[model samples]
Target: MSDTMSETNRMTETETERQEGYIPHAKQVDFSSFDEEMLRKTFPNSVATDVSLCAEGVLMTARSKSNDPQVTFNISDMYRAAGYKQTATGSCVPFAPEDVKTIVLKIKGSTSGLLEFFYATGSLTTATADCSVTGSYIGGEDWWYVMLDLSRQRNGQYTERFNNGCRIDWSTDVQKGDTFILGEMLFFSNRSEGKAYADSRNKIASTTIGKTGYGDDMPAEGVEAGYYVCLYQNKLGSDAAGVSATFGTTGLEDAISFCNSRKQLGYRVSDEKGNVVYAPYTLLQCDILREAKYVTTYARENHFTYGDAPINPAINNRAKKVSCDRLVCWVMYRVGFTDQPFTQGVVVSAMHTWSEENGFIEITDKNDLQPGDIILVKPNGSGTYALHTFLFAGAARQKGMYFRYDHGSDTRIMSHQPNVQELELPGAPFWRAYRPVATATNNIYYDRYYAD
Candidate 1:
């Protein structure tokens, strides 16, 4: 046999592959930018229930079956989107187990059994060709949480066994055809004997079936309470997955009323006039006022801003809002901030400044400020010397807080700040921050990237 054939056989027999064992030539050919839209078209596994382009990288959610809902996705698709391709004969991306430090799955599954998640790590040698599966238990029910970080591995391969699973991985390759397969959030069941169907109790409660899912109709506690009202509910019935709902009279009425009430609080409410209205700043404050917590500290301790035109920048930006503001608002509103701006600036920024030099302070500049850092401010006031500051908490509402609070209405809570001019600097900062937060949702403007 030739010398090359002999060397390959020896290495395979001994599992002695080194990092420099195979030096593949780097191609010099240029190609179009990695197009996620295009990359998704290549594989059956590309479709995801949710897809998000984040600071760390692209994140996607797909459905599968196992002990519960299992999620899987591929690094290969990301690589292709990043402009890499798989060689014709190659298995695709050749990844060492150590390269991946974290793997997470936001799961929803049956409670009876543990959920198993799998990943396809194309191997460099035939002896190591095997899939890796990771398992976890979400107890029971359709719940969600971050999964394991199997960065630690034995050898250059990783493997786990379970009844069923799905996974998401980042591949090292960027070429077409040669890509890793990925999936996310799959449902797994305890009974491995056959498919697990929803029990009779799994059906949407008959009381909730036709009634509006939000407002007083929903439970005060638990997963089923509150409405995620969608303005387009009437337009897109069952087909609508994100926000659209099917209930008619009550559903439509509740949605409209909620939006209209919040319209005064810088929250955007779409109208037939082809004009978008903004809520007022006071409304944001009042939202917190209503949700006042006894622990008050935690609830408002890390509060932030929620508009395009914040009082300042740095502390009052978008990232902070999504990670903090919006989440808190959703939680408190669910807990009982039924009034306008249900969870507005005050409550949103409540936790901002607890000490002497604290309160919501807008930064005239963002580039100079670091995230999670506090924002300080000194607003002009009639008092001797006004120096109040709120933590530069963060931005919660993107699309720059819109509501009926026109400056003309001095009593208005949520107010409309012009998208351009006057609040430009502060508003501009909010838009940049909102870009990433808005991308998290596959809502109405799903096709459009973040916009002011």
Candidate 2:
């Protein structure tokens, strides 16, 4: 992959974020949306990530790369970022038609990886033409706000209250993973809050869905800005009114009792912050389907060499030899579960696998071999002290059960059935599984240097 491709594709993954925009909760009038003073107070300026980015409940998808060449949209992972432009205008699903006056297009994001801003507006709608406005960032400033003067668009444009359509036009090709959001194109009343309360749409789309939970104004819940956040609530006021018991543990028992009294389950989003850490199932899927293909690649590169690279060039190409151990370790480390010593002891040991010390637990139970779990192998029962490790890609076609194995060779992680020796050896090859301990609530961040 190209450096640019890797950089762009690997970043900005919205893994299992709350979908759609905000809904007024519990029959409450949205006191959240700010008027002029509140708007300025709520957002003296706009921040892209802070705001939801949908328009009319759905942010417009990429049209073409450049009719508005100044813009770029990333729709899916691994696909090339393209220039998008508006191709046609179709719908006008306004949230509140009567309150459309000072429509604000508060854009806060970058282009070509450089911070840039774009905002535009045109005339109000009538039976004839539609309202329109367009402009690029005037300054080097990558962020800015544009409060559209809808009154001016209304003054001489249309005398009647015909709903100006909120339709957008796009001619460019959208790809597989492209997902347009709803909060992206929301417009607020000059007096009311946009469906999104914040200057940006993210507020409306995901309340408190920023880097932190809810919103930043929400105090750090005893978490030093980590994925694992714990709410240390206080019961200092001593409200015994609803409580029949006084089980204590930092308000948790009280909270639980309150729910139990009503026969409800009170809970939090994450136990820690495990849900957002790279998804465990997806990570496993990659290990099973994707990592299995690397064996051939590894073998070709190493030519089955046992140790590190820089294999002596003088050695005959066919004579070069490599061990499957290196291939297995390479696959494990690549998928972010590198905890074993690169030696035979860890490979075949009933205990002391490197993963035991890392952020993983050993799965000794025979029934726990799930696909994507890493497995240590002594190909045939006649396993030797020297064993090989591979991924538990999936199940096989045998009557009882056959595990489809995948591991790296000097060239690649084997994509096909490995060269399993049917020969049996005492204590030769033992099979065991390693499962990552991270989950939707528990995760390890100390070693996770890569951006989520």
Candidate 3:
């Protein structure tokens, strides 16, 4: 394929994240109607991931680029996750609507782990748990995504029902252009309490979602001053938590528990100093399906080739090439970070092969595979099955029982008939089961870099 077609096809699925006005969570509140503009002002410093609303509830994502083994955000006034637009109205046009039924929050990382997601409101000066969020270890790409249901309660007071020690502060009403902060504030002593891996959003402030934030007050040590956020979004936390109570709450919470209970630094959402507001982070009601498709399509469209692009390419000009996206997604699915978004490339490159020895399928002589192992299948290269990668979700010895797989070409993950197509493999086809492991390259810093 010519480079022009390759470039155009690749850009097809990519969407530019530009600045857009925030929309309120409430139906009656039209943040878009007002002629509001974001005012420039310095933010307070604290340590803890915070979450709030600007025109609406925003999603935040981030990563750790540093070599630090562990980090956290635990201060007041620090925005663990937040979004706001300073309005000339002088009145707060709340980001999150009082009647908002739910908020779905999603996050991810490179390792199979868990992260803590917190929701806090009111002045960062006074810290309270608006809501505590989490994403479980949904394998493969070390990603996590969950939904928070805030619509259940009309009152602002935090309720014990969801373990969120937060209640909408009667003192500060939600407002437009009102400052919504997330992830560490600088007010507390320990600033490195909350940190996220990678984040994205369709609503919330562009600054707060996937990165870290900062405030003026500096503590003796730990973390730095600035907006340390991960991702941002609009309307609803999104993901996992559809528009249901029983299903979302139970399923999401249960998933989180399963991932966190494990050993890896696993917990949904980064652990920050914010209050828990909702429960059972389900998939975002807005675009869960669309986003899933986008991720899969992006992977299929763009691929990396090591030694010059493949020659003669296979069918559809799909030469033998490695796909990190497919592998990571499958691994993540097996591990448990379900409903999460993964865009970054995988840790290892995929291998392409062309052979006629075996029919178009490269079958391994070994039968050792587990629930969370990586399953690779290459076409004998005769153009039979071409090339494919499967994430092992489950395996059964029962008759006609195929290994559970997540197809990199499609959006769904499932087990299917083994690839009949054959491809050349100098050695045995690689189908080794792998457990998610954390590596030094896995960690990334969201905000400013720390001197080593």
- The candidate that achieves the highest TM-score relative to the unseen native structure: 2
Q: Please give the lDDT score at residue 219 for candidate 3.
A: 22
RMSD of each: 21.4, 20.5, 22.1
Off by over 4 Å in 1: 1-44, 48-166, 171-346, 349-362, 374-452
Residue 320 displacement (Å), model 2? 8.3
Compose the digit string of candidate 3's lDDT tens values, residues 1-452. Answer: 12222332233213111234322221121122222221111122223223223433221222211111111222111111123222232222222233233333233222333233344434334334535433323323222333333333335653322221222211011112222212111111111111211123221111122122221223213222222111112112233211111111123343344333221111122212111122122212112222322333333456423222232211122443433344444233322223323333232233222111111233354354433334454444553332445444332223434433233432232212221122223442544334332223321220111113
Q: Is candidate 1 or 3 superior in TM-score?
A: 3
Q: Tell me the lDDT of model 2 at 37.
A: 39
Looking at model 3, which ten-residue stretch has the lowest summed lDDT? 184-193
Per-prediction count of colliding residue pairs?
80, 69, 163
lDDT of 1 at 426: 36
lDDT of each: 0.27, 0.31, 0.27
* Candidate 1 lDDT, 8-119, residue by residue in tens: 3344323323333221221111112223574353222432234433322233333322112223434444334433444232312223233344333333322212233345
Off by over 4 Å in 3: 1-270, 273-294, 297-372, 378-387, 394-452
Candidate 1, position 214, lDDT: 19
In model 1, the worst 10-residue window by lDDT is: 189-198
